[model samples]
Target: MASTTVADGIVDRLIDWDVARVFGYAGDGVDPILAALRRKEDRIELVTARHEEMAAFMATGNAKYGGGPGVCLATQGPGAIHLLQGLYDAKLDRRPVVALVGQVVSTALGSGYQQEVDLHTLFKDVCAQYLQVAASPQQLPHVLDNAFRTALATSSPVCVIVPHDVQQAQAPEPGQQEHGIVVSSTAYARPRTIPDVDDLESAADLLCAGRRVAILVGQGAAGAEGPLREIAERLGAGITTSLLGKPLLDESLPYHCGVMGHLGTTASADLMAGCDTLLIVGSNDPWTEYYPAPGQAKAVQVDVAARNIGTKFPVDVALVGDAVSTLNALVPLLPAQAGWRPEVERSVTAWREVAGQRVAQRPSRLNPQLVVHELSEHLPADAQVAVDVGSVTYWYARFLRLPPGVPAHLSSTLASMGSAMPYGIAAKLLHPDRPVVALAGDGAMQMNGLSELITVADRWRGWADPRFVVLVLNNGDLAEVSWEQREMEGDPRFPTSQAVPSFPYAAYADLLGLRGLRVEDPARVGPVWAEALAADRPVVVEAVVDPDVPLLPPRQPEQKVRQTLRALEREAEGGQAHELLRAQRAHEEAR
Candidate 1:
């Protein structure tokens, strides 16, 4: 016999599913659920944040860090509205999180009650599953169970909205016999296959004949770091990474050029254009306008998903299977061609010296570079990190560095903000013991609502309050660029180029009962960072970073196209130490 209170049914189901945490602050709409938890304090503890937005973000961080479904609750109206950005993030990043929202009451469904907004309708686009617990007695537990199971099974976000009246009533028994969800792998998964001796021989024959060759990698190519390096060493070809695969192979490598995307390097694209053949592995990177205008170079792609073979751009050869295994077979074929390495090595070394230095120049504070540096050092190999869009993304490829095996979550198609929190919640929920962090911009955090910070602290389980450490770079703005706009180009005023007003980050953090540390001085960064780490609880380090810091490109032009590119990618094709003085003069025209 369960307790008759509506809160009991909700809490019982959450406990049964092993939900140890719930994000969001207590309020008028969801007070029943909070009060019920007070009676059953032995089962779950509530994390209270000052802002509803923090609750969702904290939940998102926990979800990514934990590797399961994270739960967050918020009041109706603005509170529920605040959780939207984080919810959207969980959906695209493929992290699972369950959102518990409060509603005014069933009786006032259409009467336009205070803080009355249709959360179901707003959530339709982002939630993997959404359910409203309007009717009481028999439907409450069933709806709660469905929301929980759906979030866990799909590795996506789900929403469960409980109306005020129904939440106080007795919950009816669960409709289903077993509380479980089902999942299956899609048929589109990449098949495993070994490259035959004949195929390798054919590939080697082509490579041996080509004067210039390049290798392009994607996220799917992550684990093949060793194999990728081996191939580059043997061939002496330029190594260009996709946005998803930048950190795996540092551009400092002799052959490394840059990340390939619309916002990627012109020199990388230039070198790629000069290539006779391009080797692609493990990713179907959607943005290809960076490669060339098409019909420019021959290409070969290999991946686990076979459909990605000819999907993005035209390819001369498409191999379907595991990239690592396929590359392993291809290595023997590469060593067979001995003469090409010398020619390729010469060009690779030259580009590295000039490009690496120019791109490395960046501000040490809150700019994208600093964001990358702080996160790289703070996020352990075992730790999980969730990224939000905007200037934060520039930091992703330009600054933050991750070692092998670290999972960095990002948006798939829609590069939207407000997603870091939900993804973080889902990570922490699933991977409880892991340290979860949300890398967000101030604007993104605010646009989503500020009350959910409390929800992250409460992660719902007994005594363990898993922390959702937020490293927020408050530049206070939004930034975007499409190829058409980058080309149509009136003014390249990246939103970050504009100035913004100050917000009360610390005051709000303290209000939420969260440890808030504000760093106004660059010199204080080291000590404050140590304090946050030492606190070992939910904390927000509001670092005021410069908005104008440039995202340094990993590739630069040779003493050639200085005018056409920014300082970083403006060097020539040899590894010789360039005379900075003369190099500037050579391309003074392009500038």
Candidate 2:
């Protein structure tokens, strides 16, 4: 039998940490590690992606859905550079990810050899929490243990660079103690934190004093849904979530206002504007303009990280603790404000009416909103959802009503495009028994989604339940940026810049041996979704939607509306879009 090499020991340490998969691409720089992975294939699987960037994204997705430290591997230079985007995604979204990057031979250091870019400078920002270069064979478990530990403890990405020569070196014998040897174990447990009595009391007192209470939640508030609901009930408060927090809470709650931001519902805007007390839980949402005006509400912010508190909004009381414990501790001290419930309910009711109107509208082409709205009824309770960034994100935020306990994730902070396909693949691979739904726009589909589809086609055969459904909104335009130019800059749609190249996404799916369904008429939207969800194999549903339908922000100001109307008037075929914008703005005003 071959003696254990450092690369083999690295794989062993990963297995010790219960890592079932490591997403990556192969390169000669990491040949030794790839060999070890092949030898230990039974214990840990290597998931290869079309690009190193997608591999990193798969790892980030693994962390998001699996609730563990996700691991990814890559070769030197270009491979390391490609991992930055996904690592930044993990960092901004606060997910734990560990990147095992391969480096050039130790002898090649500072020789300016081919593919010898500085890996440290490239990863320093994305892996600010923990970054190290494994210099010797004996550092095997020590470097990996700290990488995993720091990633989990900080809920961020970490990096470990292993030189090619070091990976080929013989691993030190077990229990061998030497002056230079360092030993470490893969043992980590999340701390159960609760705020001190004084802080909890102060928070409770502030909450009790408000006649109109509003609560904002983010991803950090996950797993504390029960306590959150109970507290909302006790305080008669309205709850709104950041886009990241949408999956954690049930939208069916009478007092629940959907997401809060530019793409958020009118109910969330009303909730923020009308509240006297704001309770922010585990959310550092950057949409400060959508928040209640300064001095409009006395705020109490709760977060596990102290730095996050009061950073987004001014807080009178800061509760540094986990969401569940913090909310539970304040429950006993908060008194019921039954009078505020009616106002909160009114906002939710109006929002429902507006959303229904928008989805039911008959635009020149099929409405994108209608496509996502139809899924609410057919979506499986066990399905996982991955959404891409673009106008599709707006539709998803407003229209899709995810079943309670069904997990959905998106690149919220980084807002990266071409993320849905990779994320859906990761989620499906992790829980092959559950179905996955990915929503993307035409622009995102062309960016990288098209290439990742081949990865999906290759892997679906192994899935226990091969119901991976991808919804591609084919509008032939970069609708989000088009609207932003009109609204933000008072500029007309720049066809040269915003128009997307037409592609037959559904036909391409059929070519790959996957079921493909296309719906151009509004009447076929629901049936297409039903067919896709029940298909024997993975399916791609292409909905040809109208780009003219407005992505108007909730409670859009008169000045911006005027600007958008002026810009629309200048477009060659903007009359329909202009009329739609006016109607949307009128509906919001009516509410």
Candidate 3:
């Protein structure tokens, strides 16, 4: 009988779970696993990443795009530490992923080992399950199975730490008796929860009583798009989305109000404020102020997680079930109400017109909104977008209208910078035939490991089709933080937020053997985008934008305005009157 090492057993289990790829960097601690992977290279491919953080991000992206648990591997200590940011991104976003971490040899675990760290304690907050595989080889298969199962069942990351010595130990023989050694393929089941008949009736009654109804969607409502649209139409309701749920429905729908919250649309805010009944479906929008004030509107919430129901607001009726199933059940019981449809249509039209004006205005420097607007117009029907966190996210969220079926990936809950590029890479690897674009800010593009661009070039060089584009809004500063300083803190642009050295990102792309285009003129935006999109290789389009352009929220609170005015008064007294005047001009331009 052939004997297999624990590393080989782990690899075999991953293959059985249908994991076609793993992302990571090499290190001494993981050499045995690497050797086992090399032997099984034909079955599972390894994607070498420039940074361990990017590797974790790539795995998260894969889970987001591939509709399964993303897998990543990292070595002991520092390598594993670098994965925390990306792992946290997955945990917060509710993406299923499995991270395999290497550890020091079992005997040297607490002997002041060079690369030993208490990984369980370190990863406690970021993972749903943190397990260290036992030294015995017989324990490998059970640990691997549990790790994958927990990740999928909970829709969160799971970490399995393997000591270097354990990885090299021989597995039990094929015929050996073990308690949990069943090798047959087992299906990972997630049974859908259906709401009780009484609960559905109560929810329907609430909707029927209110004349003006509004629906709020989130990530949990992804598969329920058709059902949501149907229910919204049947009830003559206006629909708005949480930031993460923006792409659940096409924005071009007549009754669809864009996004709601700090980065929301005026129409959506107005719709939510005026509605007599609010139906929140599968969203846990943390911004309490954005929802209808307590006692202002009755609410009915539907969510699969029982804990999430009524967590954000007071729900008169709570339906606990899968969104698609619950929505379908509730729709049949709702009464058609056309009385509120016309008002919603009028509000949506007016909102779009005002939004159009903002995107149309030409500044002294190229406007970031216009760039996103043009990209939206030029993209293919099936194009996928990966948006970074910053001011650029504001434009993408507002300007880009994702048609139904086109996926848009973002670090929404975590709100992390530098996710765009890695997301784009993973999306392209999953759907090489489709067009993928990463919309990012200059600061975010630099922070989250821009060196991964070389990884893209190297991986896709020989591919038959590679259509990935990174569009950097190069404003030469952390524009979002600068805006926050002025708006939230009532402070002038301080050195901490203002000084970011401009780098030629396009030139850097060129050095990495990918197509690169630089656009300083607004007139060249369309042409450059066209050229870059048509390229057979991965491309970078760096569009220079005005740093002075302020990112104003759709609806500014009255208190915020008062604070800004008071800050301006303070600045005027400090012999910085010119700065106050500049702030006023920028605010006017944004409006």
lDDT per model vs. reference: 0.63, 0.93, 0.83
Residue-level lDDT of model 2, residues 1-591, one tens digit each, is 334999999998899999999999999889999999999999999999999999999999999997488888999999988999999999999999999999999999999987998898888999999999999887788999999999999999999999999999998886567787876787788899999999999889889888899999999998889989988999899999999999999899999999999999999999999999999998999999999998899999999999898998899999999999888888888776684888899999999999988887888999898999999999999999999999999999999999999999999999999899989999998999999999999999999999999999998999999999999999999999999999999999999999999999999999999988999998888888889999999999999999999999999889989999999999999999999888887777888
Report the Cα lDDT for residue 241, model 3.
94
Per-residue lDDT tens digits of candidate 1, residues 1-591?
Answer: 856777787887777777676777878999998987777678875766566656665666666554346788898998888888667666655557888888998889989989999888877878845655545555666666667666765557888788898788865444334445222221122235666666666766666565577888886676688888888777667777776676567655656666666545544655566677778887667776566457766777777666678778787777766788888877777753343445445555544344344334334344344445555556566666777776667666544667556666755445766667666655665666766667777776775524445556555242244556777777554433321122233233343443344687766777776778887565566666667655646778787775444332323334222332332223231111123323422332132
lDDT digits (tens) for residues 156-269 of candidate 3: 898988889988988776545657654433367888899999989988888988889999999889799888988989889999999889988989999999998877777787
Clashes of 1: 83
Report the CA-based lDDT of candidate 1 relative to the real structure: 0.63
Cα displacement (angstroms), candidate 2, residue 579, comes to 0.6
Between the candidate structures 1 and 2, which one is better when assessed by lDDT?
A: 2
| Clash count for each candidate, listed in order shown | 83, 0, 0
Candidate 1 residues lying further than 4 Å off, grouped into runs, are 1-7, 36-45, 111-116, 128-155, 164-166, 173-258, 262-286, 296-311, 314-356, 359-388, 410-413, 417-488, 492-497, 502-591
Backbone-clash count (model 2):
0
Sort order, TM-score high to low = 2, 3, 1
Each candidate structure's TM-score, on Cα atoms with residue i matched to residue i, is 0.65, 0.99, 0.94
